[model samples]
Each structure stands twice: as C-alpha cells, then as structure tokens.
Target: MGTDVQVLYFGILREMYVQAREEHFSLASGATVADLVERIGERHPPFVPIRERIRIAVNEEFAASGHVLSSGDTVALIPPIAGGSDRYCVVTDEPLRIDPLVDAVAGPGQGAVVAFVGTVRDENEGHEVTELRYEAYSAMALRALNSVIDRCEQSARGARVAVSHRIGELQVGDAAVVLAASAPHRAEAFAAARMCIELLKQEVPIWKRETSPDGAEWLGMRP
Candidate 1:
C-alpha cells in the first residue's frame, strides 16, 4: 500500500524543471513530508542543495516536515516569497505607478503624503544584473500586505496606507514597489510609510530572483 500524492510547484521553483507544473508521486504508506522531499530530490538533483530552505505545504496549509502524508493529498513546494490586495494593497504584474498609490491614501485633512518606490538596479552583490524576476503567491501575499497596512493605520492615528508590488520579470530601472501613506502631520505620515515598507519586505511572501550574465538564482533560500 502507498500514498498517491499530487505535487505543485510555484514561484521560482517553476523555472527549475522542464516538466509540467504539477506532478504525481507515490510514497510508501505513513510517509512524511521529508519522505516526499527525499523522493523529489532523487529526480531533481537541484532541489537537494536548497532543500533546507524550502517549505512544504500540505493541502494549502503550511505543514511540518515530519507531518504524515495521506493518500490523495495535494502538496506544494513553496520557496521563500518576496510578500500581499485590493486598491490599498495590490499585487500585480503590470508596471507600478506611484501617483495612483499616493492618491489612494491621500485625502482631505491630511497634511502630508509620503511615497516610496523600489526600482530594479543594474548591480547587486557585485554582479552585473540584466533582469530580475519577482514571484509571489498572490492571494496569500495580498492578505499579508493588508495586514501590514492595517497595523500601520492603527499605530499612526489618522494615517492611511497603501502599497503595490509588481510581479513577473522586470528590467533595470523598472519600478518594483510603490508605497504611500497620508496623515494629519508630516511626522505621522513618515512613520506610517516606514512601517509599511519594513513590514512589506520582511513578512511578504514575494521572492526575488536576480539574473546576471552568469545565470539566475532565487534569493533568500540559502542553506
């Protein structure tokens, strides 16, 4: 007897293999997430090196490596994401514009509005980069961003916050993120804007993949 499982690949993992996005696997009964990973490692040697950084999600929920797998279970291989929704918190592949984001949070009674933009640079880690790819788990990522905005709003009285992150491939000089905040005073607006950017980078599931003349690699998954 064995457990039949479906495996899914997302973000930077999709570029690792030439096969379809989803694959089926057979694991011995009572297998754990680690067991399933070992099986995957056998076929895809590239996974072995970064195996420790990869997280396993069983049935759409994060699971421990030791969790037991059941027959017909669906598993996803999640790489560290770059991280979150609506007009206030957006996750899009289209070009990011600062004006719209600024407007979203700007309104009457607000004396100061601050905006931040993160652009693709030509150099990183002493390497000459040509392109960068951002991957994300959209729905979940959006929720995370919303949480950030909610917290910023609560911390800064009368402050409004909005953020947008761009997904997919981007060239040098492309805008990757647009964040804005408005408040009754300049100090409040600045504080809210800082909180949003810091939280967005740390908690968001958006992952960055840098491409240079040598090759491309997904960051934040180091062993």
Candidate 2:
C-alpha cells in the first residue's frame, strides 16, 4: 500500500487527532508503518497513546504496526470505542414542558413551529448505560451553538429560537438536548431547527462520556 492514505482515528482517537491533525507531516516516499507513527508523534505528542491502545488498519484491513506503507495506501488509526448516549439528550432546565424543552418557542400568529428534544436512552448499541457525562469546551461549544441559533433566526426572520444541552453527568430521563424554532410558518421553523441541529453536531466541541454496567467510556473528544 502507498504511504499517503487517509487516516481516520475516530472513537477514542480524537484526543490524538486533535493534537496531530494540527501539524504538518512529511514522509519519505516509501516510509514504513513505524516511520509514519513516529512522524505523527514528532508532530503531535498526544499520539504517544497509539503505542499502547491504538489499532492500525491499512486499506480497511487490520495491520500490524510494522506494516509497510506505500503511496496511495489508506492508513487508519482506530482507537477504542468510548460509549455513546442512548439517545439525544435535549433540555432546558428552567421550565417544564410536556412536549420537551423545544416547546419554548411559541407565537400566536406563527403558522409553523418546530422543536427537537433529545432524550437519554437506557442503552446504547446493546450496552446498558447508567448515566452520561457531557464535557464542553464552553467557549467553543457555546459559540457554535449560538451560531446555529443565529442562523436559524436569520433564515426565518420572525422566528424565535432556543437551544440548550446538558453538561456533566446525567442519569436516564434527564434532558440532554433541546432545539426550538418558531417562524411565520411551520416549514421554515422545522427546516431551521433541523439545520441548526445538524450544524451543532458537526461543529460543536462538546464531548459525551457514557458510564455503563460494564465500565465508563468517553464518547467523543473531551472538550
């Protein structure tokens, strides 16, 4: 395989990806597996974790650390899977709503209103989860979330929008997610909320950790 392949270190890999993805790396034309990883570490110290728990894959197949890397070969770094939440947790702590936190956006003349509530599920991918811990890079996460809300409001000028998510450990039934938008009509409100949620998921620097009967695992990069 070629040495210049796309690398994916998802799951528990973010801790390392965050550091390594930041720096530029160069490899000799026919570097070996050890060479690439060494270069990665030289560029970003966090990748040192790879020496122990990280897994290597070449072109979608598992490979030993000594595997040779050729030009055009896809190299992937797979970190252990940290647990994920049972469901999307959406919430707003101040008020109680029968319909979920997103119901906060309401207007009499508005023809359309839309909201999304993410609940905590009891299980994730078959694991019995006891609770979830959310960690946020407050400044970045909030900025991203507010930006999403702003976009929702801009697209539907008359819309009222709200977004609230929980941080810290949360038990089942706790609200972990909330998105609400009200517009001149339902379609715009719904569309705006959907877009906002998608953007938040993609851009926000929030991470979730899950504690299950078996053990505790991180869901994403700790922000």
Candidate 3:
C-alpha cells in the first residue's frame, strides 16, 4: 500500500523549483519525513544541497525528521522564509531602507511622515546577543503584512502606510524592520505607524532566532 501526501515548498526552495515545488507524492506506507526529503532530492538533485537545513511541517505544524507520514498529510519544506521576500510589504534578505519607504508613503497632501526603524541590539533579556536569525511562512506572512497596512490605513483617516522587514542572519546594529506612515497630521501618522507595527507583530507568522554566546533558540514571534 502507498500513503499519499501533498508536499509544499517555501522561500528559496520555492523560487528554485517554482511551480514544481508543490507536488503530490505517493510514498511507501509509514514513511518518515526524512524519507520524503530523500525522495524529493531524487526527483530534484538541487534539493540535495540544502536538505539538512529544510524544516518540514506536517499540516502547518513543524514536524521532526522522524515524524511518520500519514495519507492526506500536507508537508511543507520551509527554507529560511525571512530568507526571502516580495518587496512593498517586504520580507526580504536585502538590507532594509527607510528612505524609500518614507518617500513611498509621503504624498502631496500628507504633511506628516512617521518613520520607524527596528534594529538588532547587542543584548536581550540580560543576554549578550551575537546575532539574530529571522524566518517566516513567506506566503502567509506577506498577506499578514498587507493586512496590517490595510488596518492602519483604515483606522487612521488619511493615513498611507509602507513596511519592510528583513530575514536571515543579522548582526547587531542591523535594521530588522523599517516602516513609514504618512497622514495629513502628525497624530494620524504616528498612530498608523504604531498600529501597523503592533498588528504586524501580533498577526504575522514570522519567527526569530536569538543567538547568545552560550546557546540559541527560536521563537514564533518576530525579533
């Protein structure tokens, strides 16, 4: 007997394989995630290079390599999602630029532009943070980011908003996020900017990994 599964890909993997990244596979009964990965590699030799780093998810939940696959399961091969992005509601690996975002939102009628930049600090929770790694479920994260922009613009009258977030390993002093909110007045701009960021944190599916001198751990929240 064979167990069938839906395999999905994200980030770099998705870009590399394009439409072929998602496929329906029939595997031997009781196959493990590792076996699925190997099977994919056999189909696409390029997948072999990053096989070890790809995180597998079963039905939207992160699954271990040894997790047994069941028929009808949805498996996602997640490459570092913050590892890539689509600009505008940007989740990119490129350095964050606030000027572009500021100019983007600023308009002829808008008199105030509230710009916010989030940088990686050298310490967190009394720990000396050496670096930070960011990840996201790219497709969903983009939608979540756009949702925040929509909410801010609607709630704050005359507000125009733009946001950019970076992923991948970043050092201290690097900009993790940059945003601008423009409005006819300072209050509206400020309110929209604040609301956008708060909503992004609450709703987006981005993750952060903090590395200290001793150890490192990942969080479901943005850093």
Candidate 4:
C-alpha cells in the first residue's frame, strides 16, 4: 500500500499550486524526499522551474533529499521569511533585535557567545543603493532558518543558536539579519555563528531588492 503524506507549499509554490496549501500525496512506502519532489514536479509543471531552489522539511525540521518519509508525515516545500521571534528561527517585518537573540543562545555552561549582524549597505556592485527591501516565503524561510541553526548546532557540539531576519523596507545601516551562537569555547561559538549566517544566505529563500538612483532590482534567483 502507498503512504499518504501531507504536503504543504509556501511562497511561490503556494501561489503556483493554488488548489490548496496542504494536500495529501500518495507515495510508495519508504519513499525518499527526492521521490516525493519528483512526483510533485511531474504533476505540476510550474514546480519544474524551481525544483532546484526549493527546500524540503518534514514535520517542521529540514529534511535531506534522501530523507525517508512515512504515512502521516507532513512535508513542507519552503520558499523562505521576515521579522523576529524568540524561537530559533524567525522572520518578520519588524526591525531585528540583537541583544535578545544573543541572550537566547547564551547559557550557563557556555563560555563564549558570538553574534553577527548583517545590515543594509550603502552600495552594491558599485551601485549607490538608497534603500533595501526584503521579502520571504515565511513558512519555508522559517524552516530554512531552523535548518541552518540545526546544522550549526550539530557542527559545533553543545552550541545553541538563534537567528532573525527582517523584511520590508530598510534604510542604510539598518539591521537586516542577526545570528547568535553560544558554546563552551570561543572557537565553537565563532564557527557556529559563521556557519549559521553563511548557510542562511546560501540556503534560505529570502530575497532582497535594492533601490538605487538608477532603478530597483531584485536580487537572487527569480521564481
């Protein structure tokens, strides 16, 4: 018998798959995440365009392409998010707060806390940027953020991680993202913090638009 997995779509995927945000998909028993994605791509032509950009999460945690799924599992096709929350992964329109995120990752046993803040810059590629706007596929972004945190935590044993990204209009010098990592040693904390931000930029589905004197341009892959 086939397994009935609950599949969820967010961001562009939600817009493309308008029938429903959540659907029951039938897959062979012991199906891998890649198998389900392949099925979806075949069923929905639009999914084929972003097949590589999309990330998968099973039951709210990031799942690998090879991760196995079972009946009743909830699989989410994450797009990316904004804003801040106490949770390890947050996306919001509100301005990012750094102190709380740093404190959140700090613990009694942790001797080092590393924090990284990414702010809107005045220029990019020689273009004089006036302001920046950020957007995300919230549900997917949150999942991706959590995935980055999970990786950082795993790479830096005993480390705790917290991260936040801000959406909407942001001026130069405004904080766009903040990441914090705490561990028993400075090395681990530093490594975790670096990994968290790098993975976030590379993996998360957050998009940025730059408004310059010339014009406005959206950055990253088009959906």
User: Can you list the residue pairs that collide in candidate 4?
Assistant: 80-141, 82-91, 82-92, 83-91, 83-92
In terms of lDDT, the best-performing candidate is 1
User: Where is the poorest 10-residue window by lDDT in model 3?
Assistant: 79-88
lDDT of 3 by residue, 114-166 (tens): 99999999988788999999988867776688778877889878888878788
Reference-based lDDT, residue 119, model 1: 98
Per-residue alpha-carbon lDDT of candidate 1 for residues 122-217, written as tens digits (9 for 90 to 100): 998788999999988876886688788888988978898978798999999999999999999999999999999999999999999999999998
Model 3 root-mean-square deviation? 14.6
Badly placed stretches (over 4 Å) of model 2 are 1-104, 221-223
lDDT of every model, 2 decimals: 0.81, 0.62, 0.80, 0.79
Candidates 1 and 4 compared: the better one by lDDT is 1
Please identify which of the two predictions, 2 or 3, would achieve the higher lDDT against the true structure.
3
lDDT of 2 at 83: 25
Taking all chains together, each candidate's TM-score versus the true structure is: 0.61, 0.51, 0.61, 0.61
Cα misplacement distance, residue 26 of candidate 1 (Å): 49
The full ranking of all candidates by lDDT, starting with the best, is 1, 3, 4, 2
What are the per-model C-alpha RMSD values against the true structure?
13.2, 17.9, 14.6, 11.4
Q: Which portions of model 3 miss their true places by more than 4 Å?
A: 1-87, 220-223
Query: How many clashing pairs per prediction, in order?
Result: 12, 16, 0, 5
Cα deviation in Å at residue 22, candidate 3? 21
Instruction: Give the CA lDDT, 0 to 100, for residue 47 in model 3.
Output: 75
